[model samples]
Target chain A: MTLDLDFHSTLYLIGLIAVFVFALTGALAAAKRELDILAFVFVGIVTGIGGGTIRDLLLRTDQIFWIADPNYLTVCIVASVMTYFFAHWVIKIDRILLWMDAAGIALFAVLGTSKALSYEVAPLIAILMGVISSTLGSAIRDLMIQVKLVIFEPEIYVTACLLGSLSYVVLSHFGINEVYNILLSSGAAFLLRVLAIELDLRFPS
Target chain B: MTLDLDFHSTLYLIGLIAVFVFALTGALAAAKRELDILAFVFVGIVTGIGGGTIRDLLLRTDQIFWIADPNYLTVCIVASVMTYFFAHWVIKIDRILLWMDAAGIALFAVLGTSKALSYEVAPLIAILMGVISSTLGSAIRDLMIQVKLVIFEPEIYVTACLLGSLSYVVLSHFGINEVYNILLSSGAAFLLRVLAIELDLRFPS
Candidate 1:
């Protein structure tokens, strides 16, 4: 159990780092017509911290992540600065980065579910929180840009996260090894998202 | 007390209607994008429901706003259609509508605070939720469009909601009538917002 907990902790840290990077990507994407530096930082921080903030607030935790560990805030700042400098070069890599986003989704979904379960919430609520943590950053990023959210599209995006959370909950309920459960759930979600993109599979109206 | 409860419930429904209008505004904004009808509906529903959804989730309510009141779903669709058809003319009266938005902020803040207090959350938490319920829809809209959030700016927006929530809590503690408390709190918030806009008063960064 200790090893399981440690593994989840490591995954959570890495997942948070990914959120910072993606938030920077979002800020860069939206920077148009001489973007203000503070605005860029604000967007990056909001996109990065939003999902976890909601998660913590809903869970009634006293320690908000950035407040508890300033490292996350530092990471957001560094990511924003890096994106500000390299935005032109990075913009050319949008397609490849979409896959990174998919990976980030899977990672956050698994990590969120683990955290929610740790708080002794019901499996259903835990799974929902996992999906929210994974999807909300991009949702926020989309709303800020005045675009329709990609998650609300007729695609596998949020559905993949939901399925992944389901997988984790089911495996944990069956006493499966934590590492194996995480791998299976994440892999399943990643593959589904990739397949949806490649095959152009969409939800029916 | 029964009359007061009925009055609060009436305010809540009006707030929901305002949210419906906001959701339709999102749909109308997206109408030129060649989006399918369902896409328009989705955006409208998301815009209308997003704030209260966040509020309910944070309050740990089972499910969310529209989930409990499917009438909100109909309201969103009808409002979206109405906006799409009349937006060309409505855009001409944008200044008047701005005041309507202020009304929305006032009512939502009061309803949000009352609901949070009913849930027995901390006073500070209730105040925060009031702010969230008032500002979250526009925040979601801005985030999705990748626009800078007005809340983080040197604006008095969230400050007004916060002050109103504080007023409600203080008055209620002093055994004020609920209707009078809501009226005082909401009136204060509305006046502050209008004055901030007129006087160009903003937060010092």
Candidate 2:
């Protein structure tokens, strides 16, 4: 059954989903390290909210989104606790979880770019913000867990996010409806990421 | 010769010095890793401004200090380039550099706590901010370079900063002038750190 939702609400849902997915990944990382409950919670929260926090700081948003709304923090904590207990099950669905994360970050990049554009920043800065928003939280998470950063790897991860953000900026400039801008851009990004995962795409050495 | 300076200017100078010292450490890390110049610059900037950036973000400062004034960024960049070429000389004086970094972070912690207190956050949060300010940049630098985090080490590093910030909060609550509050707290922190290094102080296992 199709659910009816307005544009703003849809965007909000997308952002929330991204945060939740990132938090889960963080918890999973902490679990992989056999860390304590507190570490799980800390990693989850940082992975969930860190990118947006960096974005808001750069843009000088009137209020940091999560700080202004404690719900996001609560969600991260809850996700971490749940993952701490159910890590085995979470790990069992690795492929599906990876796909979900891919979709989540694609949508998140669009949201970040859109937000920056609205703030009247340079288009290049908006694109950079988009990439940063999608990537930084996970990078911080990996760092905390002492894993290699994905960006430092040969993957197409950052390239896909960059293209998605650039697409949003380009489409918006051409007066495309924002809803279309988001869907088309994020859809392309998600597809590229999925292909990369399936084919093990890497930049030529 | 000691040049006379106003209180505000003195604080500004202290902050700038901290940024430069932190940037030097960051560049030295990049040098150790045999990274390219761009990586050196990137890591240096992140390490230099990271702590204060976290502090400003938590407190929602009116403007991000570096973005509002380009001088801080310039200082970090310059310090990184200088260190990249002179890393051997800097390393030769490792003992002196450690002491300088300790003093810099101690002063930085007081600045963070003092700023948070001005915003009227809880005293505990102010103290936490202080520690975050002094410690986070170096933490980020280590993470970037895949070094073991100092906080996770047995050393009394974070403890020193925490005590410094706490001292400032307590003194301010007792109606001490801010200048004296800064001096007493940071001085105590620096002394503690020096003692820790000399005596190989570690948190009891």
Tens-place lDDT per residue, model 2, A1-205, is: 1333676777777777778888999999888877666567668988998888888888988777775666677778788898988999989988887888898789878889999999999999999999989999999888787888877787888888888999999999999987788999999999998999889898886
* Candidate 1 chain B, poorest ten consecutive residues by summed lDDT: B29-38
Residues B152-173 of candidate 2 have per-residue lDDT tens digits of 4656777789889999999999
- At residue A49, candidate 1 shows an lDDT of 74
Off by over 4 Å in 1: A1-13, A32-34, B1-205
lDDT of 1 by residue, B1-205 (tens): 7987888688868776678767766676556453445456656766777787789987888556654456766787777777667767767766666666677787788778988999999988898888888888777665554447766887788888888888988898899988899889999988998888778898988
Q: DockQ of candidates 1 onward, in order?
A: 0.11, 0.13
How accurate locally is residue B175 in candidate 1, as Cα lDDT from 0 to 100?
A: 90
Candidate 2 stretches greater than 4 Å from native: A1-5, A199-203, B1-53, B62-131, B134-138, B144-146, B153-205
Please give the RMSD of candidate 2 to the true structure: 6.9
lDDT of 1 at B153: 83
